[model samples]
Target: MTVVPPLTRMPHLRHVLAPVLAALLVATVIAVGPGSSPAAAQQAGSPPVVVRGGGWGHSVGMSQYGAFAQAKAGRSHGDILRHYYQGVNVGGANVPGEVRVGLLQNQPSILVRSSSRNGSQPSAPVKVNLGNGQIDVAWCGGCAPIDWAIAFEGGRWVLKDTSGAIRGEGGGPVTV
Candidate 1:
């Protein structure tokens, strides 16, 4: 003979099951109540039992993972951008010949390199003018190139010349 403990003897179990049993009872009542549909009954409940859900994120821009998935499914670059941006033309405009490439965004200083020749580093790093986004390289033999830098300074982005003078500032963010 098996003797089962009463609900009073199982306080923890009772506590865990009470809300669940109550919900089930309420759901059943709402599901089978006279004349009214389950959906309508649920919508008209007192103190309203509601359900909510979340979505991807709070961005109005392209999702990187979504774009990657599209690419994997053989979508072209223009197709991917169009799908995300909506009704935007995917054509090229006249871009600056030598644009300031932002390599290290969060760094104080960056060491720029030259790829003109093998084992030949520029005497001074090529500093692109922040004002015009132009590189003034002195091609005279053995002349040191002017050092250019893009650095985060004083709570904003700045373009500095070789002598550490600010040429340009505050363009939101510098991108390649």
Candidate 2:
């Protein structure tokens, strides 16, 4: 029988009993608080930065519930990596995106963030990095638990309004 050494050997996940749990807890807190930027507050004319969190992504490395099939398939970490990172080559640790916010609930949500110089307006295309939460894929887009926008246009991502969220389905070709 083929034997896989272990799940996580990295110093970070060294002690699953502690480090991993701590990390998960941290992610949970961030997710449950208020997943919004200060700009969102300014837009609402609110003074204090609101705390937002509790996204479905688990706010951790990988959602245990989501990747169940992947693990069951006996795919090694390398295979899993390849499955997730289709176009990009995972050779070095030189990951892109400065990670303005590592709190993103997605996996490797890489995006070229462009910002206005004056800082008067919010950035365009929120550019989120969700793992398995796409409109077609993450059926819950309408009621998707998390609003961790990986990308936003003119300071928003979803096609709905600021207060307008999705309910059932959308994102397909519109017919007249």
What is the lDDT, from 0 to 100, of the residue 160 in candidate 2?
36
Question: lDDT scores for all predictions?
Answer: 0.46, 0.33
Across 145-169, the per-residue lDDT of candidate 1 in tens digits comes to 4455667566555766667887565
* Residue pairs of candidate 1 with colliding backbone atoms: 127-148
- Model 2, stretches more than 4 Å misplaced? 1-18, 21-28, 32-35, 38-150, 159-176
Q: Pick the candidate with the highest TM-score.
A: 1
Off by over 4 Å in 1: 1-106, 113-142
Give the count of colliding residue pairs in each prediction.
Answer: 1, 20
Best by lDDT: 1
